[model samples]
Target: MIGFARTVRLWFDPREIRQEGVTPDYRFSLANERTFLAWLRTALALIGGGFAVDQFLPGLRWGWRVGLALALLAAGVVCSLRAVNHWVRCERAMRRGEDLPVSRFPALLSLAVAVVAVAMVVVVLVGWEG
Candidate 1:
């Protein structure tokens, strides 16, 4: 368990974590933590939604259901990875007194979810037996 914890910490940021040049404002750090948690929650929800669609949406075509599940699962993976990278970048910027980095992940996530929504609409209008 101790080793696992260490691994998780390193996963969050290997090089810059406590290569912390200095501690910045605690409020900024707290805000960063909250943002990370929010992204994590969103990722979890996407994963759960994918599972629910796979399990509960019996009227959907098999191909349509699988496609939706795959898309949501893929998006969740992308969100999780982006969350870690974002946390690392934000923490590094804070420690160095530099501008925080921006990520295109938010736009990527939006686009992905929008595409999934449109696909779902088409699926509903098409071969859905119910």
Candidate 2:
């Protein structure tokens, strides 16, 4: 059971993230894992938010409803995908004693959420029927 659980964890986690840059300090590796988990949490929140909007907000027009749901879902997927890649890259950099990688996804995600929030406000205030 323990082995199976470990396997499942490895499947989701970047456990092998240190393959390229072995022997980095445990603290660095743990930090990398924490960062990866943070990204995963963000992805999960985005996905959950999408689901909540789709299920609970029935007042929205079909076009707007579906668009918002898809946007959130896509953002979630993007964040998850980027998380793994970023984890691997950062781990490798750490192993090589290089600087941490610059993260573009956070900025992109913040911008996306901001745009969606603004659009939602407009829809609510203006009664956007389409």
Most TM-score-accurate candidate? 1
**Cα shift from native, residue 73, model 1 (Å):** 0.9
Candidate closest to the true structure, highest lDDT: 1
How far residue 62's Cα lies from its native spot in candidate 1, in Å, is 1.5
Per-residue accuracy of model 1 over 26-124 as CA lDDT, tens digit each: 998999999999999999999998998799888997888998999899889888877876787788778988989877778878888998888887887
Clashing pairs in 1: none
Residue 19 error for model 2, in Å? 5.7
TM-score per prediction, in order, is 0.84, 0.80
What TM-score does model 1 achieve against the real structure? Answer: 0.84
Clashing pairs in 2: none
Q: Residue-wise lDDT of candidate 2 within 13-78, one digit each (tens)?
A: 655544545588789889989999999999999999899878877888887888888889999999
